[model samples]
Structures are given as C-alpha cells and as structure tokens.
Target: MELLSAVPFVGGALGAIVPFLVVLGIVVFVHEYGHYIVGRWCGIDAEVFSVGFGPKLVGWTDRRGTHWQIAALPLGGYVRFVGDMDPASAGKADDGDLTPEQRKHAFHNARLWRRAATVAAGPMFNFILSFVIFAALALAVGRASNAPVIGELRPELAGQVDLRPGDRILAVAGQPVETFGEIIAAFVRANGAEVEVEVERDGEKLAVPVSYRLASRIDYVNPGMPASRAGLVAGDVIVAIDGQPVASFYDLQLVTAAKPAGQEIVIDVTRDGELMTFRFMPDMVERPHPVTGETQPLPTIGIRAIGLGGIDPTLEPRGLGEALESGFAQTTRIVTGTINYVGDLIFANADPGQLGGPIRIAQISGEKAEEGLMSFVYLIAIISTSIGLLNLFPIPVLDGGHLMFYAAEALRGRPVGNAAIRVGTMIGLSLVLLLMVFATYNDLARL
Candidate 1:
C-alpha cells in the first residue's frame, strides 16, 4: 500500500518504500525462520516467531505451540525461545524452579554446539540464499561476456548509419574503449551530444561520424517519474541540463548529482529534430553505493539510457553450466569487493558516507524492480549476502558476538558468567544503536 502511493512528496521516494518493505520482510522472515527452526531441531521450545517489531498485527499459534505473527513495523524480526528473558533471546536466569520437562526443552540447557549452531543458522541461511539466487539468475539470464562488436543491427537503423557486423568498437565519441562495458560507459559520458565512433574493420580502423545521432537517449521511463511527468519521451536526446551542454550520458549524472534534491532545473532536448526546453525539479533519490554498499543520495530525472548508435555482439551467450560457474564467481567478486571497500572506510581512506542503512537498501530494491524482475531478484541475492556478512561481525547482539561468547566458553570449559554476558549484551546493543543512528543520519541527508 505504501509503495502504491503517488510520487514522493519532496524527493519522490514514497513508491520506493513499498518495495523496500517487501525486501525487508522477505529477508527478515528467512533470518528469523532459521533461528526458530534450528532451535526446534535442537530441542529448544520457541515461544513465538515474529516478523517485525513493536505492536502485533496478525498471528496464529502453530501445532508446536509457537506463535507466528506479523507486526506493525516491518523493519526486523525475531524468535523468542523458552527460558529466554526477552525477545532478543537472552537466557532466563536461575532456571532451577522450572519443571524438568520445560528445562529439558529450554534453549539455555542445550549443548554448547547446539546453541552455537542455532545462533549461526540465521546468517548461514542468508549465505545459502545468496548462492541459490545467484545461481538461478545465471541460469535464467545468460552470463554477461564479450566486447562490443556489431553482429547485427536493427533493419531500419542499419540503413541510417554506416555500421556492419564484425566491426569491433574501439571507441565512442572519441573515447577509447575495448569492452562492451567501456563502450556503454563512453556513451553515458556523452549524455546527448552527437559524437564519432571508431571501429576496427578488416584490420583497418575507421571513424564514423554520428553527428545526427545522440550519445545517450531514453530507453525506459517509469510512469510518474520525474522525466515522464515533465513530458520527456523515450528516445529524446538530452542536449543540455540547466543550459550547460551535455556531452555524455554520464554528464546527466554529474549535472544532477551535484545539484541538491528537489531543486528545479532547465533541460534542453531535441526530439525528432524539434528542440524543446522544459523545467522540472530533480528528485532526490537514495541508492546503494556500487563499491561501498553505503547509501548515497543523487538527483534523478527517472530515465534509463539505451545504447545510442546501436550494438554488436562479439561473443555468444554462455550456456547454463557456464552461467552457473560465472554466477558463483560474480558473487565471490561482490563479496571481496564489499569487504575491501569496508576496510578502506575503516582505515580512513574512504568516506564514511559510504555506509548506508535500511533506506539505502529500500531505494535500490525499488529501482531494481523498475529495471525488471531479473534485476530485482539479483538484488535479493546481493542483500542476502550483505545481511550474512553483517551478522558475522563479531559484535554483541549479533550472531557473531554470540559465537564469540561460545568460543570463550569452549576455551574456559564452562558457561560464561551471566554477569559478563549481560555486560557484553549492553555493549553490543550500544554499538548497534550507534550504527543505526549514523546510517539513518546519512539517509536523511541524502533525501
């Protein structure tokens, strides 16, 4: 319902909220379900399995007597096991008064390995989800590969431009490029300005003038988005933003990103050789940073750019087996990239603004949805991996922190002093709260 709302009031963010909530709900349900199911297998009785926190909304008691419910706020979820003093699953003190049967099924009474396994299951599930999703995407969508070479061109446009199959694109708008990605990037940097493309054909390079073509043009437009609402059409060539000439699609990004959200700006475009000028406010949007996994705000006109002069394929699409292989490799790259970025942030080599919280996640989820179902599913895997990695941080109030305590217990050959755990819990909660506040602040600033 929230996502169904009209465009965001100030930043046009209202629609994003729904997709964000959907993503959060799925992840939370998967996480808490892990804890609940694992505890049950370990002979620990769970009192409730809850999605979200705060006031309860709808629920039903299962056959095993565990209350399953959806709460009003869908931010996070939890599983409350028997002998737990609170919803956080902290152990109940001095369980000697409990009946033998109740004590037998109590979480605190479980073996050390069992307790550890139960706690670790949540993050473990997240990792598995990531792998599964990645594999599925690879199977469904062909693995990305190869350089930009025109293997084919649309029949109509093939006559308009001097392009042909087997021509390897070497540069766009005079920007040297090798791979398809670089070619796309070059086009983006051109925005809407007419340019030239150099290609290698028959061992000889030729420069083709695309003076009548655009560097970047709209390919997709979501209804109610800034561009669509402002009367911008797909295929429109953006010539300028705020009177400054745009040379590349990336120019649009630079021009808008530097401007504050909700700020009004003039845009000049030529559609079918008819030049037009329009004034509209750029919407402030929060999205995940590509490298850092942090949330940052950027201005958007709500348009996706398409390849301008056309494209040629140099490599064949990979088969399912190859796709699966590449998919796993891709996920690994994401993991390593995120870890490296986080390290850079900690060492003061990177900006702290690279850290984003729920808002950032939500924004990306919505944008991905607009891209297509495949993209949205891919985002799910990425988010799942992020959750798994975050939970593994050895801080209190998280699975990793609990594992740390269990490690101490294993070394000491006995359970830790309740006093120490209580202290650690407090410290962990404080650190977690601090992170939330900081991320929230960043989100607000971006909006």
Candidate 2:
C-alpha cells in the first residue's frame, strides 16, 4: 500500500499486469490441457505442452517425452502434437525418420475423428472450466428468496422512509404484492414518487411511506470513467451535485445527464461519515445496449444502480442441481451477448472503441481484484467463456480454424494441401496481430 502511494503509476501497472497474467495464464493452461489430454486419449502423443509462445523460460521433459514448458510470451499457448511441423500444427513433420511405434502414435496418422476431437477439445475445455466456476459461485451466493421481506437496508438513507428491516412487505401503493417482483413493479408504477408501503411488523399491520427511487449510493463505478477518475468509488453516497442537494440515484442521473460534456461540475459525497468534494469534466461515452448491442452515447460520470432500492433481500441456499442450472444459464447468456456484440461490430453498428484487448482486460482485472476475491473469480469465469468462444471462430491458426480444416477434409476425403494451409495460417496470424494492435489502440485512447 505504501509503495503504491509512493509511485502510483508504476504500482497501478504492476497491479494490472499481475492479475491479467494470472487470469490469462489459467485460461490458456486449461485450453491447452484439453487438447493434450484428448490427443493422448486418441493414441496421438504430444511433443510439447506450452503455456506461451517463443523461447522457453522454463521447461521439463516428462516420462512421456512431452516437453511441458512456460514460454517467454504470456499472450497465448499451444499443444504441439507428435509429427507436427510447428506448435500450430500447420504442416506435418518428417515422419520417415520416426520409429514404427512413434510413427503410429503421430498426430497426423490418427483417425480423422480423433484429430477433430483433439482440436475441438481446447474450446470445449474452456467452456467446462467456466461452467464449473459459475456453478460454484451460484452455489456459494445462493438464490434470492421470493418472499417480500426486507432482510437489511443501507446504512445511509437519502431521505426519511418509514420502512424498517424485518418488515414483511404486504403491499405497495395500496396494491397487494404476493412476491418481491410485484413490489418492484409497484415502485416502478410510482415513477420516482413517494409511495405507501404496507408492512406487517410485530404481528401488527401498518402503512409506511417510502421513496420509489434508491438512494444515490454508488453501486458500481466504471474503471476508466469520470467518476472513477475523480476518485469516487462504490459505497460513496452522493450528497449533492454543484451545491444542489441530491437524494435519489435518479436525481443524480438526471443532473449528470443534463450537464454538457466537458462542463466542470462539483460532486459532494459522504464516505464513512466524512464529506468529500470532487470536481471533473464528465465525458460523453458510448456503450452497447444490454439487449441490442448497438452503440448508445450517454452523458455521465459512470455509475451503476444498486437495483434494490436500498433494501436487501433474503437469499436461499441452492442445491447442486439448481446451482448448475443457474450456472449454465449465466454462461449461455455471456456467450450469446458476446456473439451479439461481435455481430454488431461486424455490421458497424457498434463502437470499435468498445472492443477491448489485453490492456483493457488487465485494467478490469486489477479493478475486480481490488473489489474482492469473489469478483476476481467471477471475472475469470467470464474471460474463460469468452476465450473458449473466441477460439471457436472459424479463423485459421485458431482451434476453430483447425476444426474447419478437419471438416473440409471430411468432405473432400483428403487433407488440405500444405501450400494452402501455410497461406491460411499466415493470413490468420496477420489478422490476429492486427486485431491485437487495434484493441491496444483503443485501450491507449481510453487512457
């Protein structure tokens, strides 16, 4: 902590890089292991299992003669199968010099199905890793209880509310609510106005007045946004903006939205009972719509809503089966959303600036690590799912590209020619490098 304070930029860089390496390293290892194990199962021996590319930083040859190594670069990894010209398996190695036993166990000599499975396994394993982590998280966090009972409330209240913890919410705005969802709907119907909340307390039913909108407590702060740059963090309560008193998050949003981009504004916040002031010029930012993937430019100091209106719901522990189901659903949602965003990018409907590369990922990783262990782990699952999906894109030099070749071979009943394979590999490598450069540019622009 002292070192970070002494040299802020250097410390921040280290913080970001360490977590990024940990996350990418784990994902890459899992992906490569999937290829190695499946290849071995299909009578194809691996010559090397590398966690990165370029010269070996550290390595050891196992009993099976597979050189397991961590290479100099930390960007990506590969599994080099026996009788492969390179780690990418773009062409065949010299098999004439191999012993009879070695020749039979060569990857190129394996059955077509075996080869396809080996290439596909890398992505498949990535999905499996994400699934397991998501499932475990679901199990750990459990599910929110359906009953309309307030388990807890935020320590700081923006305004007076008659509602209290342990109150069993019976109705909202004179409308009976059987579940929490209905209560939320009733609040929405109130539309940022005060509403009557009927609650049962100490065996007595009573009416309490509550605000429809939540207090202006920061729930989430985007890492590179104006709020974060100005040193605002989650849990800080916005007390006022430009000397105008602010109560609800809605008010904060409305004020921020109305301010012109680059207009300087003062924000007063309460953190741990101490009032602090911040001044910054909020920038106009573009982000993809949650459901649409189209770019939407919104004016703001970036902060996300808490979504619960200052009330905490009760949570119920989930069984393994239920947890797994939730995990699968969550993973599927991420995969679909990513695909949609990519589709939008291809159609030019999305902002290219939103496309992040390693630097952006590193920034996020560091931020999440600071948030807590669970947040960091959850990020890992998300990145794992993304890596798995990315490798499945039909681009040469990727797992999906290999599978594409295998499919073509299946159709033609002959392997793709070495010359064609080499050309495709070169094109794929160029595309990947270009993409990295573009994404890095985006990251630098944000900085």
Scored against the true structure, residue 28 in model 2 reaches a CA lDDT of: 87
- Candidate 1: residue 149 lDDT (0-100): 75
Using Cα atoms with residue i matched to residue i, what is each candidate's TM-score against the true structure? 0.68, 0.77
RMSD of each: 9.7, 8.2
Error of 1 at 386 (Å): 1.0
lDDT of 1 at 327: 62
- Model 1 stretches astray by more than 4 angstroms: 1-13, 145-246, 249-317
Q: Candidate 2 lDDT, tens digit per residue, 1-447?
A: 000000011234788888988888898889889999999999999888888777899999999999999988776788888888887888787779788988999988899999999888988888999899989999998887868987667665445567777789998888888876566556644657888889999999998888766667888775445575456667889999999999777577667766765467789999999998876656565643322334576566678666366666778899999989988987886687567657756876445555666766777788888878988888888888888888888888888888888899999999998888889888987777788777777666655
Model 2 / residue 215 / CA error / Å? 5.3
- What's the lDDT for all of these models? 0.68, 0.76
Q: What is the lDDT of residue 77 in candidate 2?
A: 85
Could you give me the TM-score of model 1 versus the true structure?
0.68
